[model samples]
Target: MYRLTTHSAIAEIPAEHWNRLADPDTPFLHHAFLDAMERHGCVGESLGWLPHHLALRDGDDRILAVAPAYLKFNSYGEFVFDWSWADAYRRHGRAYYPKLIVASPYTPATGPRILTGATPQRRDIARVLIQGAVQVAEKLGVSSLHWLFTADDETDWLAEQGSMRRLGCQFHWRNPGYGSFDDFLGAFTAAKRKQIKRERRRVAENGIRIRRVRGDAVTESEWAIFHRLYRDTFDKRGGLPTLTLPFFQDIGERMGRNLLLVLAYHDRNIVAAAFNLIGERSLYGRHWGCFQDFHSLHFDACYYQGLEYCIEQGLTRFEPGAQGEHKVSRGFLPTATWSAHWIANADFRQAIARFLDTETRDMQDYLAEMNTHSPYRADALPDRIQAVS
Candidate 1:
């Protein structure tokens, strides 16, 4: 037997129960991470993300699965870029707000969506959880439901269950059994390698020193400066900041080692910073900002620093946020990402299906073209890794 419940609070779910379904490899899915987002008030109805997490239980009330879900009033923080879909609904005289989104708020890192228990009923739990999402959409009268930046396994499973799968691309750097940063850089072509070296040299010539501060090492003053930079960056882009100051403080206090802040200081004064989450096997670069523009500072602080940290830490992969063709030449390979959407309205669903099919083809071609310009040597490219849409 399967039971479904809507949870307004992450604390309501037992930490051990949720952690049981989470792989130690991915820290973002750990109960601590989600709870921090909630405890800090970063996710709630007023913030445009209302927690309505779905929990599945067995006959004896044992938790089987859980999905981090939210009721989204807008698609601002989700990096998957679905504003066009919302506009399409409005153009067709339909409502698109209040859609059900299964994703991490203000995060584009792909991970498991359905957390199932270690039992024969794991698949059944996923089916039930998805059905619960559909039911919630119908009951709440929302226009649609979406699962953003999900892993390939969940995407395939959802597609098998009639959800429409959409393809996207992100540039990520993966370690190829590299023993050191220089070894990894050796794989790059001479021109690209020279370009990177020049960029690093430029940052150094400007009297800027970059340092990585782990969670515990991040002082309150540092957090304040980082938050200001984060807000200023969003403001300059003419958008509201997605994260609250308290969110940063809480993450620093609770998950400090998992938090890596790459700070660029000029004359011992901080000028730029890149906030990254350190997982067991991957480093996820989430946000970046600079107080002043310096030549190649952004690249040094965001990409190169991240790569160096990953190399030194022996991490397997580094995902430096979303959507950058320039990352290809910086040794980040084009990787395909997947999302699933469900539009309750039949007409809108068909329209989106048509649009997605064409978009997928275009994305596929774009990834292939980008791969041709990859920095890595031809033999260094892994056979398992390919650009797909």
Candidate 2:
């Protein structure tokens, strides 16, 4: 027997118990990270992120499963774009706002969505969480429910349970047991190898130096500068800067060693920065910005430096944010991303099923296309596609 409940805030749950069920390698799902958003005023009804986290409990009242969910008013921060679906609902004089999303808010990285203990009843717990979420959505009368950027294994299970599976591509770099960055580059073709080397050389020749500062070591003033750079990134592109300054400070304080800041200096002045969250087995490249434009500085601050860090730290994978095909040529291979949807309306669900079927085929063909032109040398290509979950 099981009981399911939803909370309006993550703080209602204990951090220790929640983390005990999470993969240590994915820091975005950490209680500290999600709670920071709420505490720092980044998420709330006014901000369009209303918390509605789901939890499954056992007969003894022990929490057996959990899923981080939100009642979204609009499709802003979720990188799994659903604007078209929203537009469809609007055309039919229906509502899309208040739809339920199970995800790490504002994060596009894939990790565990349905978290549970490693007990014999883990699958049963997941089912309860899923059904509980759907019941909550139906009660709220929302048009749909979505699970975004989910793990591959869970995505397969959701599809089997009648959820519509959608596919998208993101470029991610993998460490191939290389001794150093140079050794990693050796796997690339001669032309690409020289191209990357030249890009790195451009930064040094321009008298720009990069320093990788751990979060605990960062001063209060440094955190301010990093936030400014992050704001500048969205300001320049005319995008909403969803993250708050306090949020940055909070994560640094609570997530300490898990945070890494890569700052670029030219003439003793900070010109750019890239922020990463270090996990036990992976490094996640999240925020990046620059005050001044230097030649190939984005590559250095964003990609090359992170790659070098991964090699030095012996990290197995690096997920540098979302949607940049240009990263593919820079040794970041095209990887498929997953999202599962439950449409409440049967007619609309069938329509989306047809659409997703076509999208899935096209995504498969696109991945095959990217593989034919992978940056790695012919001999270095792996025998099997790396299933990034």
Q: What TM-score does each of the candidates earn? A: 0.96, 0.97
Q: Which tens-of-lDDT digit does each residue in 1-389 have in candidate 2?
A: 88888999999989887888888888899999999999999899988999999888889988888889999999889998889988998899888787999998888888889988567776767877777778888998998999999888788778877789999988888786789999989888999999899999999999999999998888898999999999999999999888998998999999978999999999999999999999888888999999999898899889999999999999988999998888877888888899999999998899889989998898989887776667888888654444432
lDDT of 1 at 168: 89
lDDT of 1 by residue, 11-117 (tens): 99999999898756567777888898898777887788988888887799988888888889988788888899888878878779989988888888877788884
> Candidate 2 — which residues are off by over 4 angstroms?
384-389
Q: How close is candidate 2 to the true structure, as a TM-score?
A: 0.97
Worst 10 contiguous positions by lDDT, candidate 1: 380-389
Output the worst ten-in-a-row residue range by lDDT, candidate 2.
380-389
Count clashing residue pairs in model 2.
Answer: 0
Best by lDDT: 2
